[model samples]
Target: MVNETPQVMTIAGTDSSGGAGMTADLNTFAAHGIYGANVVVSITAQNTQGVRQVQMITPDMVMAQLKAVADDLAIRAVKTGMLGDADTVHTVAKALQQFDFGPLILDPVMVAKGGAQLLSDAAVEAVRTALMPLATLITPNIPEAEVLTGMTIQTPDEIMAAADKLHAFGTQNILIKGGHGDAPVVMDYVRLTSGDHFWMKTTRFDTQRTHGTGDTISAAITAQLGLGLDLKSAIIAGKAYVDATIRDGILVGHGYGPLNHLAVVTAQNQPEVYDDI
Candidate 1:
């Protein structure tokens, strides 16, 4: 038998701060004992403070990086985050079709914590039409879900309704993060294509260290998929990892600080953040 280490790829942007984007993805993949590959779609001059500047890599270069990784690596799963523009989003959509990476987790990173625009308004439509159909799972935060469904989400019923709208867009699974909610306990909603849904709730952590939380969670899910976990298990495991990660936060910058990627997590070490709802 061959020595097999699951290979995972992240197609997204880079954070100069090394807290989010490609840096965080590689870190998460490594933490799961998986081989990590990357295709940089953009680069940002960002730190714990915030994103100061952004430069989108050309679509051709993005495709080239994907080609290099696809040709040599046996990528078992892949996740996308922070595609800077409409062209980059479409470019990734095409590559996902051309390549056979196992599971596709699309994190619709639209805006930064410090009011920086990561994805343009036009790019949002591109992601919906082009990327959604190709994704195995689409993980969007509350605000993003609002934009995608063209409606407001104030209640849990509305959250599930938004998931319905997202489901019609073509992904088999939908996870709308509730971190932006005003509730004392944060709840993340997940829905399968068959209309089945699950809720994972954890008391909100009062902190400003959630910079790369989105990318980190999606990365963990992708790595878990590469390791042969089912979709539901992968998502819940991702939540557990993120919950532990946020709980172990450290001060890396003045603004939205980075998550504690160094936090070693196991099924046992995972906090009792799960709630029945």
Candidate 2:
């Protein structure tokens, strides 16, 4: 037997600006020391500015890519981002059932960072009915949580309620992110079926570089899962990584900026005298 890097696969859309979608997923996986494999589900004409258009990949193409990857790789963890429509969502769910893969981290990507509709209204049901149940953990930001759970989240308690509601949908765990607020402290609520709940609170970074943060967080958790970390630990690690990335993020373009996936570069480059040989 030979030692090989852990593999993580992402099924998501393509972000033309390279700040999100499959691009962000690959970067996050590489940063976490995992091999990233992906199947593009849609294409978005987007950037830090906004989304101008979207073109979804055909169901046949999605299925082919998934089959090609599943047949060839020992995928330790999987994450999903954007599914353009109900048919695509159904197709992805069907493929997952056929493959019988586990430990899926779902991002529930309905809209873009700049407020663009990525998924159609008709697809939400398909996602909830098909994909949500298959997820080991579903990571939903406040707005997405609102849509999925049909409750207006106004406070921390409401966030917990939203998590509970989402749990009723068959997902094993829920991470309701409260990062979209005017408050200084961002709160994230995680609920497990075992009656364990974690409230992770962090100081809000004072910046507009929120672009792709959700994708990064989802990918980070998936990578940790791929490396055999427990679900809670993976969530914690992923949250820390996302927070730090936001803290050290770059201000790019005229609109919302991007996360600093290269934050670990300096640490990786630090001298190891014995290893210099």
Candidate 3:
């Protein structure tokens, strides 16, 4: 008997909107044809519009969930997002360090779409000290890159500078998403600590349905890695998936909006116009 499918895990918060967090992560993995495992860190009271409130899960519960999944299933790859606070990040990092499981993807989720604080200033240090070193890759938007690097990223050159600063934190690869900048095209730059670089460019979709795009991108990358794609290839594929999802946006919420999670699976066999990638 052949299992034929890779398994990936997402350690993230829960979005009640069914758009972001674990829900989106699992859906993205499914879209990428991977079995998804998940560990919920926080329960967010959010809808299509924005995050209303967040309920932080205890560190002990997080540890228990990670241990339970790792002890049972062979997680081929893992992605971490929205760890709530410093303690939660440390706990997850400690468990990962203790068990030493699969390849890890870290999405530095510092703020929500509505400009809400998702990670604390104190916890940012914890993420750098504890988790960033163990990550196979770190996906950070421009704001997140600024937070992590303490440098303003206004141009593509500055984006490279930010990536270099993040590399010093021990992350193997840094995917700095340039969607937040003033560029007409969304250029996501992938730089490896080993001096390898890949740039993926897609015309920016002028839509507000970017709420869960980051989570979806990181999740898709993890799933692709689980399916044995190299880091650069996975990121390239992930960006394509995200761009497609945004293109297929349904405009669900009144505020920020949600992505089209099913677009990938539905369009998998369809022709690639290069728009969907």
Candidate 4:
């Protein structure tokens, strides 16, 4: 019998703690019953407490990894996490342009949950200029969205405005995650290229185990997309999946713990979707 599993790729860094980065992305793909592939862009020695030291992979090696994966695996969807610097970002962008590695889910992973900056200022510009246009979907947290759009996002209107600014960057879809806000309920705003948008609201669990929430969600979306789900459906499923992971918390490390990737999201954890702005 031929191997028939849907394959997805994650181009990101390594988190030694197994909480965030490529680890989380791969775990998410497995949980969603999808085959996972990776292109290591950076390596970090860290745990749930915090990131200690980081070593970025060379651009040539990054390109080599991309070619190796694209040459073999039938990658249906791909997502990017921490690209480290401007050079790596440009390299990844060029690779995406070169290969038909399926839809690109660009996760603008700027800072670690423990307050460590994962992306450089020059890298931010590189992503905005080079990667954004190639992204099928861009997932950015509130802080990341603010940084990318250069606007202070404090209200729902501001979030939509930021999404518009991000959409102008040429991405077909934008998901502005509201997890950084101090609200009882987290509202993630989505803007599609077809002039359709909505807000996905879920109860904010009072826990600190959101270490890999962003990666987990984006990976879930990629998995669904690889499985042939439409973009809107993939986004909705991703929100539900992450909500389950967060709600079913697991105790691993001291500081911000990692999400329970094994937790199965039931229909009860479905996010309340708002079709209006």
* lDDT (Cα atoms) of all candidates against the true structure: 0.88, 0.85, 0.85, 0.94
Please tell me which predicted candidate would have the highest lDDT against the true structure.
4
Error of model 4, residue 36, in angstroms:
0.3
Cα error, residue 81 of model 4, in Å, equals 0.2
Instruction: Count backbone overlaps in model 2.
Output: 0
Task: Order the numbered candidates by lDDT, best leading.
Answer: 4, 1, 3, 2
- Writing each residue's lDDT as its tens digit, candidate 3 over 1-277 gives 3435578899999999888899999999888778998999999999876789999999999999999987877788899999989999999999988875588999999998888899999899999999999999999999999999999888778888888889999999999887885567777788876677866677777888887989999998999999999887788778888888888878687888888988753343221222211
Residue-level lDDT tens digits of model 1 in 1-277: 3327679999989999999999999999998888899998888998887789999899999999988888877899999999989999999989889988888999999989887888899999999999999999999999999988899998888998898889888878999998984678878899977656788877788888998999999999998999999898888899888887888888787899999887867564343433335
Q: After superposition, how far is residue 6 of candidate 4 from its true place, in Å?
A: 1.0
After TM-score superposition, what is the CA distance of residue 130 in candidate 2 from its true location, in Å?
0.9
**Model 4 Cα lDDT, one tens digit per residue, 6-114:** 8999999999999999999999999999999999999999999999999999999999999998787889999999998999999999999999999999999999999
Off by over 4 Å in 1: 1-3, 266-276
What's the TM-score of every candidate structure? 0.95, 0.93, 0.93, 0.98
Segments of candidate 4 deviating more than 4 angstroms? 1-3
- Which candidate ranks first by TM-score, i.e. highest? 4
| Pairs of colliding residues, candidate 3 | none
Task: Report the alpha-carbon TM-score of model 1 versus the true structure.
Answer: 0.95
lDDT at residue 77 of model 2 (Cα atoms): 88
Residue 122 displacement in candidate 4 (angstroms): 0.6
